[model samples]
Target: MCGRNATAVYRFGRPGRVELTSAALTMAMRGFAGGGETQITAVNKDYRYTVFDRTSRTGFGEGGRHDTAMSSGLLIQRAGRTVAAKACSRDATVSAKAQAIIKPGPYVPH
Candidate 1:
């Protein structure tokens, strides 16, 4: 995950992991930071995994404070139905450059 459009691999369980190309990861992160929803699909064996993030905003401009929350997770689907779902840890932190990378755009789906 170093140079020019590399892939990032995330392991959630033994023999369970998802590999996301740089472009996909960037889009997902941008969408997540922008308080929007984004998804990336990956296939392993017979399972279809959808890694997604959903963000919600509240109290915007209220007393000069805005509250934003995001929930991220992976859903495993087989035969077009969800089989398992796992939520990412709540303690995760976004990088310091998060604000610089955000760009407004239409909803992204993959």
Candidate 2:
């Protein structure tokens, strides 16, 4: 769970790592819950860290259910292209603090 002081860490390559504080994570969560595909970015020196999420519902569903698919991950970009990317696990669980920030809508598949 990411709180006001918490941070998310991502490692790429041999020793490259990026740490995103709660502020960026919160923005990413909000972007994810808002709708459509979103990308929230944070920069440190010359590296850009981008957090992205995409949500869509299957045509077979009528209301909020398991028919919706949600995907979230992080990307490391240098120059203007991606250098590394990682996806959240399918069984990932969120803490209450993170959940409050996400505020899943009725159309969200929980």
| Highest TM-score against the true fold, candidate | 1
List, residue by residue over 1-110, the lDDT tens digit for candidate 1: 12222343334343355343333233344444437665555455565666666776754776867687877777777766778888888723333343244332332333
Each prediction's whole-model lDDT (CA)? 0.52, 0.50
Error of 2 at 63 (Å): 8.6
User: Against the hidden true structure, what lDDT does model 1 obtain?
Assistant: 0.52
RMSD (Å) of each candidate, 1 decimal: 6.5, 7.6
RMSD of 1: 6.5
Off by over 4 Å in 2: 5-35, 62-66, 91-110
Candidate 1 clashes between residue pairs 3 or more apart in a chain or in different chains: none
TM per candidate comes to 0.51, 0.48
* lDDT string, candidate 2, 1-110, tens digits: 23443443333334355343334332334433334554445566566666566766554544644466777777777776678887988624334454444423222121
